[model samples]
Target: MTANDTDTDVLIAGGGLAGATLALALARMVPQLRVTVAETFPLASNAEPSSYQPSYDARSTALAWGSKMIYDQLGLWPALAQHAAPIHHIHVSDRGHFGAARLHAAEYRQDALGYVVDNRWMGLCLVRELLKTQVQWLAPAEVTDMTCHGDNVRVTVTTAGETRELSARCLVVADGGRSDLRERLGFQVRHQPYGQNALIANVTTADSHQFSAYERFTDSGPMALLPHGSPTRASHQSALVWTLSDSELKEVLAMPDADKCTRLQKRFGWRLGRFTRIGECNHYPLALTLVDNPVRPGVALVGNAAHSLHPVAGQGFNLALRGLMTLVEQFRLAGEQGSNPGELAVLQRYQQLHRSDRVQTAGFSDSLIQIFGSPLAPLTAARNAGLMGLDLLPAAKRWFAGNAMGLGGRKARIQRPGFDNSKALNHD
Candidate 1:
């Protein structure tokens, strides 16, 4: 596919976090490339934003230090940081066990290991910043189908009540894990259920979290509490993710808010004091979702559409962000070489470069479940020893911290703000 023959250089099917981030990344790195994003959700324009209103039950995501750097390069960090709570420390422990490991931001020479912000707020900030870019946004729109021609893929888009076609040299499928397009296009997926479900909610404690995040693994299941609420102010709210088996989930799901909070307090302990309140409860089955092959001809997948892992490690979105940037880097190189982004060689190169990170990340999450889900005496003792060693070994702690912070892979080639070509790709 030659650039001049297609209606656009790249057409993204879903304008969720992955697609939106990709559009902005491309707009920054390869400004000359025509990029378009069509999403089912309506894309909001930059009309002076309304007053910030707090949603106690709002869902959130933990952005790794590396992900934050990527966003900083895109000049979106300032806005995001305003509402994001910095995770100054992370405390990992084996509940009712003897081992514990702690990671601090200062020890790692970072202001934060990560930042937590509401999912909706993040989307709003991304959308606002994206509106300032040269990329095109088509929404409340859906990319219903596509057909690949000699040099481009013609996309069928349904917007409002009308249907039309748009052609692009490259098509990126980022709809989601349950993507209709991904299914319709017949991309085979490998789905392995973990026999557990994750119960998520926002909880408040009597005392502030002090910007500390907690990861507690118990015989029952693993749970994580990320510092939430205002970034600039001390807050008592934290987002919770509790893993439970079917029967346990059924029991917990049937409880009232008070009983739910009581049960949560028992599982998490009194690290942040009593669980004063619990927000809306949401649950989803845990699974290892991997596409058999994420790339075909001019098309590729990113985010959950490509790989969705158990969230115990909180690496799912971070991994997707890294992959997104990596693909953008490939597109940048392809542009420099005057090769179409949709070219099979270009797509394969991107996939090859990204596959290791995907595999390693998915493995990390899967291993966590298997290793911790067991109740054998030997396994328990070994895990406790490992956790203790992690605390005692500085180098080992650094390695683990680095991976958790999404700094384990090769850096993407997106240029930072005010940086020139020769100075670009130096983000190591």
Candidate 2:
């Protein structure tokens, strides 16, 4: 039950996006370190590409600029570029209101405010990067059991009908929002369900999206239009995320695509012109879940295992990448200090580094969701007033844009070609 009882630098559970990327980051940062990832999914292969048809998932993600920076560092952006589209502007409004506040890339002199990417395509691209790294890929493997000792962790995994013991100085859990590992380890998390479900689908619009994103708050919930590329049949397309009350979700899900499109078109109005067709629709329940603490001695939780927020703000992946950045950087510094990368001190450094950013972003997201989702008349007036105030303050607008791009979080500086590393100190 101890790392000294076995071998390896670190053991990562769940080789999804977070686990794979963390391994990739650690390999790049600490080249000599041994990082093994245990994943139940089949190893990604060129023949079996991880492409999700809109007719299957109908869901996509918006990655902030900061997340793009991480992808750029991991050499994933180039591969994702073909399928990803940049959102140059964002329009936010109340459904019953006429004026909508717009945030434009031109105002910030930036190429794009953020990017919209198909989640499956992103996974495929990340898997490709992981393949190029030296990190050990334990695929088709399930963690049957795990235990932690004073300074190390031991894990038992079953792969290909055989059991194997894996020991490491620390364990990283990145399973998902409902992490089985976390539950098995007796970690307590607070989960708040919104009693709403997001109905996702791809819609063909008469007018082009013009690379702009839209978020409209209706009485039911928030509806987002993420600009997408041309449809499969050479038509203007946009990804829809329509959040509805639980009762409404069931009604919408039962309708055929044509009927769903008709209802959506009526509810959404003709802003993007009439939605001619709907590709596929799926429902996802909205919830807020967070672990009390991310770190406990030899254990650490990364990505969704640590926290899951409402998708309205598109901060889930951004927060995960941010955590990865901090952890990898801490490992780098630990190695430089002649210490084991997965030791308690090193792990604590990683935890402390991300605490501030995590708390701030989570609270910010909670406040925004609660304020905007409320039907209180006074709060509604205040919300509009706040938007109007933001419109008047150029500096505030820029800051908001920066935050949406994930730049509001602490950013680690990458040493340049001629920079003096000895003189540089950790900014945070």
Q: Among these predicted structures, which one has the highest TM-score?
A: 1
Candidate 2 per-residue lDDT over residues 290-379, each given as its tens digit = 886778777789999999987777778788889888888887887788776657788788788788778877876777678889999998
C-alpha positional error of residue 422 in candidate 1 after TM-score superposition, expressed in Å: 15
TM-score, model 1 to reference: 0.94
Clashing residue pairs in all predictions, respectively, total 0, 0
Candidate 1: how many backbone clashes? 0
Q: List, residue by residue over 4-99, the lDDT tens digit for candidate 1.
A: 767788999898888888899998888989999998987555422354566998889999887898899888888888888999889999988989
Error of 1 at 28 (Å): 0.9
Every model's TM-score = 0.94, 0.90
**lDDT (0 to 1) per candidate:** 0.85, 0.76
